[model samples]
Target chain A: MVDSVTTINSDGSRYFLYPADARGRFSLARRLSAYGLIVVYLLLPWIPVGGHPAVFIDIAERRFHFLGYTLAAQDTWLLFFGVSGLGFALFFLTALFGRLWCGWACPQTVFLDHVFRRIERWLEGDAVARRALQLAPMGPSKFARRAVKHLLYFFASLLITHLFLAYFVSLPELWLFMRAAPGEHWAAFLFVFIAAGLLYFNFAWFREQLCIVICPYGRLQSALTDDHTLVIGYDARRGEPRGRAGTPAAGACIACNRCVQVCPTGIDIRHGLQLECIGCAACIDACDEVMTKIHRPLGLVRYDSLAGLTGGVTRWVRPRTILYGGLLLLGIIVATFAFSSVQPANFLIYRMSGAAYFVGAEEVRDQFMVRIVNKRPTPATFTVSLEGLPAGMRQTGFLAPVTLAAQEELVSPLILLIDRKYYHGAFKFTVKVADAARTFSLARSVEFMGPDANLLTEDDHEKHRHR
Target chain B: MNSQPQPPHGPEAEPALRPHSYDGIREYDQRLPNWWLNTLYGAIVFWIAYWFVYMIAGLVPSDGAQVDAAMARIEATKMASSIDVTNDDKFWEMSTNPVFVEAGKQTYNSLCFPCHLASLRGKSENPTAIGPDLTDTAWIHGGTPKEMYVTIKNGVIAKGMPAWDPVIGQKKASEVLAYILSYHKKGGTITLQAP
Candidate 1:
């Protein structure tokens, strides 16, 4: 019955699928796209941008470089926009074209269908032969084929995981680590092996089960998509009645079961849109190839909205789409602004670990610690200056432009002293630091703390009288 | 497309629906996949092994003991790197060393210059400066190198000189002391002054 899962036997044992290969336009297009994605993945760490890998996430240095721009650990708050932007974009796309990412761009599908499945097909022949081989006893020929196939799977997984590690350590450092003994970099070594093992297990035996049971996106289709959303469906209106080729009053469907045979998830598409479908368009291609041979029009099973499949017009502009699109657009705008506003340096002003303000015989003073951090990969000189100080106030420390090495930080005391004559109680002032090239500047406002102005003048009068 | 249903596989009949219904919804009583069940069994086996090794058998050291050992190693390294603050001749030697003086100068300019002035002259260089002159042999607290170390390490609170030992630690405090001593001779004329 269609009520139960096709890949689960009645005895509760696993039921592996041997999906027949489908060849048509959609299959060809998806193959090309998957290959393009795989090439992009493999080349990102090899390509250098601005003296670093294109997408290096240098966790050891706590600097994440995307394209040419770099972000220090302090700029980690920008990750909020990145994560949310991806979420909203997915929501919008899912509401518009259902499960497009799953069938096309998802790493699981790309690796499993394009990479591992091709290896399996080349070694074991077509679907029927593969099923027969599985049913047969463990002979020498069968054992050798299984061993070679699994060995190849393990190697492919290891290669992928090694490239994945290059994203974090960069290609040059990864090469160094690869050449070194595993004991020297035990953590990274363990990580790569463990990740590769997991990938091998996932791609080798746990194939369609991951999409049907593990992935939450497939389950969210009902909530993310509606009637008008594009989905691969059977045209029940045009292909309902079952009949042979020459039967009168028969619909276009000739009961060839080509759609069911080519299903990767093993669900009958003619039974209508179901959760098991990943929307890969395999059934559409299979049905088209079948209908063309029998002198019937194509699209017996095709990509169409549920409304269109039921002989109704599909509405593209729905309330769900507008909301999702608006949210995605807002996230993009905010993410752009946040990324552009990231400064190449950071500074902070804090009270030195002492009395907030010092009072001496001839002056009133405020002491602060100004900490400056250069986030660039090269050395830069920063000039520290004070602004909005009262007249007759003298400044000390960081008088000259201090040069800091790459990613270096410095903490120095900034002392501001006002002569007793010009000391007019406590006031607010700014401590500003800027690069030598005047590329950017950071300022912090600090309140000069002291006793009342009247008290100082009264003390002065008392001193004069004593003299 | 046929009205007739296909026969169920294996020895089992059709999957039986649960007797109870909640708002017209009854779930089927289907057995879980063997592979999924194997994962549960594997987790149980791992838990037993881990508990036996780490908790009951105690083959591995406790986390607390590991932390204590790490802390002791750090303490040993700290003690090895620390210098004797009470040695007067060592202070004089560090004062004469150019590397020590240069490092001390950097620390001095960053911190001590605010009160003592960049020249270490304090009130002598500018009448408005906050601290006493370090260049003079007259000492308000003490005149010897050890006494100067003590004064710098534990400042005179009544005079507004902060205790710097906690802020800069023993090493940088000693370095700043060396920078101050760089301006003076080892046996220069010394006089005691009342605060």
Candidate 2:
């Protein structure tokens, strides 16, 4: 067992690993799931759901569409729920199953292990042959293999990044941008190329180093996990005092080191659970394969908790897991409620850029600018009305239902006047905006400013006395 | 599993620990990967070059200068699109055009209708309206196109008319004037009256 990072040499140089292939149930299941995830990633921009791509962001228009639901810029606060909900979900999963996301779902692990490594394995053969090719001096055959492998990696990266861009710009717009001159859409062009370059650099060479050295989730394992967390661990009780088969006083382990050979991060699983373990179960599969061949029971190295490996029962319902799960449930509920509450339009009522209120000869008036924004994809007619206003109050502008085009916004004056007989002190009233069909409504409480009622009455009495 | 040479301390030798211990926990001082070190060095070099170019050599324009240039460009565009407010004939011509009048009427109804009334007859139609009658031959602030334009652009502040030029730009202000002119004849009687 090495005390330091296994993938880094004592001299600080990179020790590249070529993990041997382990063909077993876990590996096969992982491969199928990875393929499913990749297909979903590629098809999201192609499948149209409710007139838009299934997951279009539409950054230029500031509308984010997921499935059929759309969120306008005014609904940006909902992003807090979306982000926090994902965070709590990750925390809950991590507390229950150690590094399951890193092994099965992380884009870095998925692309590197399945796509890039598969390409390398096909071109340069298995672990032993790949290592030999790496050590061999430059030759025509070796050069051709390396060049072709790198070319394929680059193209794969470009494909991934282009699809990523399509999520924001939509597929048709991305196609237009691609066909246009680079100078015409230089920002998007530069973004795509830069992203593709970074992805190629990551998947091609920076494999397990990302999980071991860079990923914050891997670093968070110690804090998020405990003895009850399911993890990939070796059974020291069964596999200790390793020796050849049929040797007396030796445990079941033949000291074959098959588990270490298949480890992508180059760590010995028999040394116990380490930070480098991504829970890929490669070591488990390798050990199981060897145990079966030797006519012994499988699972010398297997998925179990620290307690389970030590012959203790694993507690599945711990306090840590319960807290995380509860939080996650709360987040989901709140996010669902918040998303449903988002209205199809936004409105703001602000005092106009003059006096707060004007007192005329026979009336008291207030001027306001009502800005209405229609966030829906279709034109909507909205009816504006004053609620809880005193009698004899007059409202001008928005006398009829105003119709706004798709995603259009309009700012217009709204004037309210009261006859001297009905003049009252400054008061608060509600400005109600409802759809023409009265399906949904939004209201903002606005204060109508005016002079004191007694002051207006005093002026009237003074004028009357003088007359 | 290749037969690579082990470190000089032997395969079973443990890594040496650092001198300091915090709360019963000690750390191993391992070397950072050469690739990570190279990235750090690259960032330092980039920072030095950026500092020299932007701060010392002044090769790229400062952020303030860039903002100023952008603002200047926007001002130039606004000036180019603005109508000639001083031209009386242009205002009369625009009043005769239905396109200008329609756009102006929309703006007027949305903003000016409360005080002036939708019919543009202010107190004449409704005695308690805020503004004076616009359709009348008598003019409080001169009734000619240019005078009326001045009155609309820079408002009569004492009488509660807001300066429309800043609220709506010069173009929309002129459009509003065109809509008002559509109600009157060019050579009609004009009598200046006291407020």
Candidate 3:
């Protein structure tokens, strides 16, 4: 309402932006970033780290593998902290540099500006030829070119889909899926098929509408950015009341509109910051190229913070940035400590379902059930024994080791038999369990009722015989 | 009657296709991206090929059939490695063999000894043993092998005898029954504590 700039109209007609090709210092950096990001996206799923995919999510088993470390379903808290750390990092970056990610690093912009543009320029020629071809009459040459271009887009979408699917399924399993019959894996097939179609639409048509209308990350800009946030800005004060070059005592700007033509989202930078700008530095490149021809100094459109534009110093350190940084560091420390101390198997012991305790001729017996879960991804053998067996207590009734597979639990019956003489009130002992190799051990304490020890003596055997 | 003239595409160099003005702004009729149109056409082509192989020619099996086949393969691997004690007739035949009795004695000592005692007399002082005396000529249920096998498998619930089939599996359960039957036929006088 303030500047009379609207992107989507009620009439359903939109002005298309055709940014001319630009080569500059920033352009080189943006291009390199685009290549690096695309490579990471494509190759991350294929590489193996510690016998696992570098990053994989096995949804069926609720396991996540990140850089060789595996986190089971119970360890979901670690994943939550990891996500929060990423969020804090984003906040910190936004506070220092306004919308830098949206311009140079965002996938939407990178694909459109780097990949799709190169494809477009290679086939349809520059901006002028592209516009002419659109208005030109239908012909065989035009149809052939259109067909080839579309074919390339379809195949490109399929490649991207394959790379995307690698993050969820393991490599060998994915290979098996690829070799399997289509109907056998119809669910996976349909997912990739539909995803390819969507990617094609996004890269080819949706373009800036994805960034301008949908991405809520941009909406956070207003709240996150302060006066010190560096953004691509045009110095309107010195360049206004514009005129053609060489007019006596005229303002520096010639009203060329080259900056507008070079913008990915077609907005004149001279109108100040707008939501559609994206801060790509394309206008800066275009303006500088023009300034060189006109024998004037460059930097008409440049990276300047709000304070700098208003003749004030740009402050780099602020309270908001410090808070986000501190939180991110704290999340990493706490998550690492918790992950290291997690138990491999959870042990629980309780009295058997039937009787509490029973006295035999020479011994007292209490039935119990030891429940154990093997948390590893492989089978483990466990031997259970009673620790602190005061004087004469023995483990009886199936004194053998048990083996359980991944995530499997056992509720085997156990009976603790202690000599009647050793029976006393409130005796404490621990149920100790270790793997066959004694690699690890777990202990839990349980209590049993007994006759008073003081009453016991050489006459205890006589009392046992009477019972 | 006056016919309206068509609007002109604003100075062809710019992005505008028509000269119609809205808030003093111009809009061009930009052709849809060639890649987008091609992708739609490609999808149509792909769907046709998929329909031919998966629907018409029937190259892929139905989901249910595929799953059933995979399940059978897994079950077969597990079945081949263990004794098929599920067949009660075959298990009864095997129970009469000398090898089964030998194995059965080991199972009885480990599992049945606590209640029946090494003496097989089923005698205990405090709380009294729940297991019936195995040497008695009068069987609690029946003296027949089938009756004893069923007793071991199903257990006498009211007498606090938990079913052994689930805990030790069918093979071991059959063996334990064989061990008890051996003593019943011989009327062994073995004693643990002279009781």
Q: Which candidate has the top score in TM-score?
A: 2
Candidate 3 docking quality: incorrect, acceptable, medium or high: incorrect
**Per-residue lDDT of candidate 1, residues B28-73 (tens digit):** 9887777888889999999999999999999988999899999999
Report the Cα lDDT for residue B162, model 1. 75
Candidate 3: stretches off by over 4 Å: A1-6, A248-251, A343-392, A396-415, A419-467, B1-87, B92-195
Give the per-residue lDDT digits (tens) of candidate 1, residues A1-467. 56677787777776787888999999999999999999999999999998889999999999999998889999999999989998999999999899899889999989999999999999998888888899899999999999999999999999999999999999889999999999999999999999999999999998998888789999999999999999999998899787888899988898887787788888888877789889899999999998998878999899889999999999999999999999999999999999888988999998766677777888887777889999987899999988898798988778789999988988887777888899888888888899999998998888988879999999999999999
lDDT tens digits, residue span B1-195, model 2 = 453233343357577789999998999877888999999999999999999999999999999999999999999998998877888889999999999999999999878987898899998998877788888899999989999999998887766677788888788888899999999899999999998
User: In candidate 3, residue B170 scores what lDDT?
Assistant: 65
* Candidate number with the higher lDDT (2 or 3): 2
What tens digits encode model 2's per-residue C-alpha lDDT throughout A317-389?
9999999999999999999899889999999999877677888887788888899999887899999998989
Pitting candidate 2 against candidate 3, the one with the higher TM-score is 2
lDDT of 3 by residue, A295-381 (tens): 788888889987887678898888877887787778778777878866667678887543456655567767666788887767888
Task: Provide DockQ values for all models, in the order shown.
Answer: 0.39, 0.46, 0.07
> lDDT of candidate 1 vs native?
0.88
Model 1 docking category:
acceptable
Give the top-scoring candidate (DockQ). 2
lDDT of 2: 0.89
